[model samples]
Target chain A: MNALLEAQGLHLRFGAVRALDDVALSIWPGEVVAIVGESGSGKSSLLRVLAGMQRADAGQVLYRDAAGATHSILDASDAALRRLMRSDWGFVHQNARDALRMEVSAGGNVGERLMAAGNRHYGNIREVAAHWLERVEMDPARIDETPKNFSGGMQQRLQIARTLVTSPRLVFMDEPTGGLDVSVQAKLLDLIRGLVADLGLAVLLVTHDIAAARLLAHRIMVMRHGQVVEEGLTDRVLDDPRHPYTQLLVSSVLAA
Target chain B: MIVLHTEALAKSFTLHLQGGVSIPVLRDVELTLRAGECVALAGPSGAGKSTLMRCLYGNYGADSGRILLRHEGAMIDIAAADARVMRAVRRDTLGYVSQFLRVIPRVPTLDIVAEPMRARGVAPDEARARAAALLTRLNMPPALHGLPPATFSGGEQQRVNLARGFAAGHPVLLLDEPTASLDAANAEVVIALIAEAKAAGCAIIGIFHDTAVRQRVADRLFQILPVYEPA
Candidate 1:
C-alpha cells in the first residue's frame, strides 16, 4: 500500500512489433525489484519504459512523490521529466558510456550534478568528487582523469559516482554489470549490493544472470515474450519456482 | 483503501531480429498495495516482474489496464496519463532508490545529498545541514561528507547513497536490494532505515536476494505467473 509508482495497461510497439502490452506493476518506497529474462525477453524495453527513456503507445504510468502527491509519468512534459531525472530520480545505464560524459574528468563528472543544482565553489566540487572516488574504491588521484583513460571497471565506478552524487530518490538501471569481466562484475556487484542496502534504494534491475538477481534483488520478476511469467520473493522463486517455465529457468541456471 | 492497485495489466514484446517474433511478457496481472506494506514479488527468471515494476513506475507503457492510486483526495490512473501529469506525479509522489548511485562527477557527498532539498528551494545552508544530519544518522563519517564519495569503500559509498535517499523523506520508496554487498553492520543500518520508513507510513516495494532481510521487512508476497505454459 502507500505506493510510490504504479503502471496499468501499458502498451507499446515498434513498427508491426509489440514491445510491451498490458503490463502492470507497482513500487513502494524503499524496495528493490528485479526484472529477469532472456536477452530477447523485453527486459530492457520494460526498464526503459519505467524510466521514461522510451514512449509507449498506450497505457499510463503514475508516480507518487515524497510529499504524498501523485502525477502521471506517461503524461509528463520533456522538461518536467527531465527535472525528475535531475532531482527525484537517477538512472544507471548498462554501459558506462551511455550514462557518463566520457570526456569529463572524474571530478567534473561528480561535481557537475552539484553545479547543475547551483553549487559554484570549484574547490568544494573537486573535493567532493575525490571523496566519492574513494568511496567507490577508485584512486582519488584519478579524479582529474577522464573516463576514457580509466579501466572498464573504473569507468563504471566513475559513472556510479556521478549518478549517485546527487542522491536522486528513484534510480533506473539496465544491466549495470553486463559488459565487465567476471572478476570486475563481481567487484562491481559487491559495491552495488552494499550501496543499495545502505541507501534503502528502490531499484529495477534487468539482467539474465540469476546469481546477480539472487545477490541483489529482493523480489524477482521473470519475463518471457514481453510479459511477466512469474514473480515473487527472490529465494522462493529461485528455489521453488511454480510455473513450468520458471522451473526450467531455475534448473537451467543451477545446471549452469 | 489501497494506496495503489492495478487491474487486468498486460504486456508483450516483439523481436525485430527474428522477423518480429511476438512475445507476451505479462498477461492479466492484478495487484493491490497499502501503506506500510512491503510486498515481495516472486516468479521465474523471465516472468516480467521487472516489467511490471517499470509499468508501475511509468517507465514501460501498458497495453490495457488501470493503475489506480489514492492521493491528496483524488484518484488517478497512471496508465493513460500525459507527459505533464506524469512529471508532477514523479516530483511529489514517487521515490525510487536504484541499484547504482549515479552522480555528476566531482560533486561532494554533502551537495549530492543536499541537491534534492535545493531543488525544492531550500536554502543551500539549510539543505546542507539536513544532508549532514542524514549522513551522520546513516553513520557516514563527517570527513566524508565534504568529499565526493567516489573513492570510498563500497560500504561507505552506499552509506552516502542511503543518506541521499533519506534526505527527501519520501512517503513511498522503491528499493532494489537495499543490502547486497554490505557487511553485517552496514546491512543492519539499512534494515533499521527500512523499519523506520515503514513505521513512518511509507509504502515500500523492493527486490531483495537476502531471505533473512526479506522475511524481516516484507508484509506479504505477490506472485506473477508466466504467460505461456511450458510444453
Candidate 2:
C-alpha cells in the first residue's frame, strides 16, 4: 500500500539546537502513528514539518494524493499547500484557542471548514455542522453559542468537529487532549478514538503523554535530542522498550 | 486445523534497580494449539507460565522467537505485528481473559461485557443482549446489570471479565486463571462455558490451577518447565 505521507532525512535546527535530525516516517491510510518525547524533543517540529506548517532545513516530505500522484510537500507552492489543507488535510492545534474562532458561534466554526471546501448551500452547511456537533457529543442546541462560553473540553471538541467536518484523509494532531482536566482528557480521547475509527482517518499525532499514545496510536516513535531513538508497535514499545531512553520514558509514567 | 503456535520463544527481565541483573524466564519454548482444543498450561509457581501467556498475548515482547497465529485466514507473527494488526487480530481472532477484571470506573457491567462485541461492529442492542445472557448464565442477576462491577465481589467481577472475554467469540482465546475467584458453582459454569466454546470450534489456552476444573475443561496439558540457572 502506498503511504499517505512519507518523510526522509528531516533536519531542522534553531541556532545550536537541533529540533529535528534525520527523522523519517511513513503514515499509511487509516494508520495512527504517534511521535512521543519530552518537551523540546522535536516531536512538534516533525509534525509541523510534515504538515507543511514549517519547513525543514533538509529532507524530503512526499504526500501521495488519492489519485496516486506524489507531491513534494516542501516544494509545494503556498497556494497548493493551502488547497491541500482545505481539502485533504486537517490540523488540530494543542490549544483550541489557536485553532478556533472563539468569537464565532460553535456551528460556524464547523461550517467554515465546509465553506472553505466549497460548500455553498446555507441549509446544507448548517445541517452538516449540526450533525458534526452531535458526532463530537455536543448538543446541537449550542450551535449559536460562541466557543469562548464553553469549557476547555467543549472548545477542544468543537475544534475537533471543525477539523473533521470535511472528512480529510489525513490529520495532524498536536496534543489534542493537552491542557484539559484528566477526566475531560479521557472523554476527549474516547471521542477521538471513535471518530478516527469510524472515518478511517490517517493521523500523525504528537504527544508527550505515553498513555494517550498507547491508547490512540498504532505505532510509536520515541524521540530524544531531536533524534528518533526507537520506533515500533505501541504495545511492544511500551511493554518492552529496547532503547534505553524509551525504557526510561516508559518506566517514568505513573501507573493508573 | 492449527490455530496458533510458538517457535523458540524466549523472554527475560532485567532488574535495572538491582545492579542490572537479568533473570531468564522462558527459553526456546515450543507449543501449539488447534481449533476445538483446550490446552491447559501446567507447571508449578515460577515456571514461567504467566510469562509465556503474556508473550503469547503480546503483553510482553518475545526476546527471540515468533508467536505465529492464524489471523484473518493468514498466519501472522504476533511477536512482530504492529499495533494496528494486533488490534485487528484481537478484535476478530484472539481474546484474553486475565485473572482480574480491569474495571473501568462508572461503566455498567453489561456495557463492560458488551464492549468487545461493540468493537467488532456488533449492534449495541445485540451485544448487550448477549452480555446479559452470558452474565445470567454465570449467575449474575439482572438487578446488577446496570451497576458497575467495581464494587462487586471477586467472583462476580471474574464472571464479568469472563463474559467480556467470551463475548466477542474470537477463534483463539487465552484464559489466565479464569476461575480463580469463582466458587464451586461458578467454576462449574465456567467449565460449561469452555465446553460450549470448544464444541463451537474455538481454540483455547488456559491456566486452571484447580485440578478438577482443569481435568474437565482441558483436552490436554502443555507443561512449562522453568529455566533454572547456576547460582
Candidate 3:
C-alpha cells in the first residue's frame, strides 16, 4: 500500500499541558488506522493537528496524492487546508450537528458539500442528497426537514452521508459511534467498514472502543499520556499486546 | 405521576417550493412522561420525533391535540396557555438543549451555561458562581469560563450544552442528542449527569438513537417504528 498520508515527530501543547509529544502516524491508501487512547491521552489533539484545526508546535504532516507529489500540511495556511478539505478530505465529529447546519433542510446539509465543490443547481443537489441519504438509511421524504427534528443517531447518519457524498479520497472519523447504543454502534461500525472498503478511501479513525478498532482498523496505534506506546496490525496487537498500556486497555475491555 | 401528557398530538407544515406545493410533516401521535423520568425516542429520520418534541416544549404549535401538564390539583391545558403564561411556565419549569444552536457568539462559555439561572431570576453573582460550578462538574477549566463558546471545539460545546440543560434546576429538562458526538468517556459522564438530574426530581425528555444512552437514562424506552428500513 502506498503511504497516502504521514505525520512525523508532531509536537503539540495546550498551555502547559503536553497534548502531543513527538507523535508520528502514517496512513496508506485504502487503509484504516485506529488511534486508541484514554480520555486525556491526546488522541483528539493529534487528530485536530492533522486536520489543521490546531497548529502543532513542531514536526510535519505530509500527504502524498496518487500523483506521487507530496504536500506538507503542517506548513500549509488555513485557507489552503480548507481548500484541501473541500475536495480531497473529509472530517466527521462525534456529533453530526456540529458538522452540519441545523436551520437548513437535511438535503441542504448533504448538498452543501457538493455546493462547496461547485454544484449549485438545486435539483442536482436534491437528487444527489436523496441518493446519499438512501445509502445512509435515512428517509428520502424527510430530506426537506431541518436536522433539529431528526433523532441523534439519524443526524449522525446524515453527517456521514454528507461527507461520503463528496467522494473524498481520505476521511477522518473521531469516535463515530461514541454516544450510540451497542446495537446501533455495531450496525454503524458495520456500515462504515463496508463503506470504507467499497469506497477504497484511506481513513484515520480515532476511537475508544477496542472492538471498533478490531473491526475497522487495518492497524492499531495505542496511545497513552500523549504518546504512542504500541503499534502493529490490529488483530496481532489486540491478540498479543506488547505495551503495558495496550495490555491494560485490552484487558479492561475483556474484563468488562 | 404523569406530569406531561399529549393525546393524538399532531403537527404538520406546508413545504412550498418553487411551485406552491404542500406536504405533511407530522402525523397524529401520542406521548406521555411522568415526574422524574427520562424517556428515549428512537427512529429513522422524518419519523416526526423532533416535531413531536417541539410541540411538547411549546416551541411549535400543535395543529390538533391536547397537551396537558399535571399541576397540583388539576391538569393544566398547556395547549391553551397564553404566550405570556407559556413564557413564564418555560422560565421556571423547563430546560432545553437542542442538537445545535449551542454556540452563542461573543458570550463567554460560562455565561452561556449560566443563562438558565439568570432566566429564572438567579442573582448575577450567584449565577456566575453556579456557572463556574457547572463547568467544573463537566471537567472544563475555569479559564474557558470567560472565553466565548465559539472558541471551543464540537465536543466542548456539546459539554456546555449538556451542563446548561442538566444544571438549570428546572422541573422538566429537554435535551436533543446531548451526547450525540461525544466520545465514550464523555458520553458516559453525560449519561451519569442525566441520571443524576433525573434523581433530583427533574423530568427529562431526551431523544437519542444511541443504545448506550437509552440504556443509561431511559427508564422507559419508547420504541417508535423507524420510518425507513433498518440498515
Best by TM-score: 2
Worst 10 residues of 1 chain A by lDDT: A235-244
Clashes of 2: 0
Better of 1 and 2 by TM-score: 2
State the weakest 10-residue window (summed lDDT) of model 2 chain B: B13-22
Residue B144 of candidate 3: its Cα lDDT? 88
- Candidate 3 stretches with Cα past 4 Å from truth are B1-231
C-alpha lDDT values of all predictions: 0.77, 0.92, 0.79
Residue lDDT tens for model 1, A1-256? 4767788888887777666767887776667778888877778888888777788888888888788788788788888888788877888888888877888888988998878766799998888888888888999988778889988898888888888887777778788899899889978987887677667778888888888888788678898877888776675467546566666676677532
- Which pairs clash in model 2? none
Over 4 Å off in model 2, which ranges?
B15-19, B103-112, B118-128, B142-153
Q: Write the per-residue lDDT of candidate 3 for residues A71-113, one digit (tens) a residue.
A: 7998888888998898889998998868989998899999999
Point to the candidate with the largest lDDT. Answer: 2
The residue-by-residue lDDT of candidate 2 on A1-256, one tens digit each, is 8889999999999999999989899999989999999999999999999999999999999999889999899999999999999999999999999999988999999999999999999999999999999999999999999998999999999999999999899999999999999999988987898789778899999999998898888889999999999887787789777777887898899998
Quote the positional error of residue B3 for candidate 1 in Å.
Answer: 28
Residue A188 local lDDT, model 3: 81
Residue range B1-231, candidate 2, lDDT tens digits:
999989999899875545677889999999999999999999999998988888888877788889999998988999888766787888899899999887755679999899889888899999999999999999999999999898999889999999999999999999999999998898988999999999999999999999989999999999998898878
lDDT, candidate 1, B1-231, per-residue tens = 477788998876544344556678888888888888888777766788777776776666677888876555576898776434554555566566655565434568998898766645689899999999888877787888888776888767767777777677666666766677578877778888888888888787777778888888889878887899456
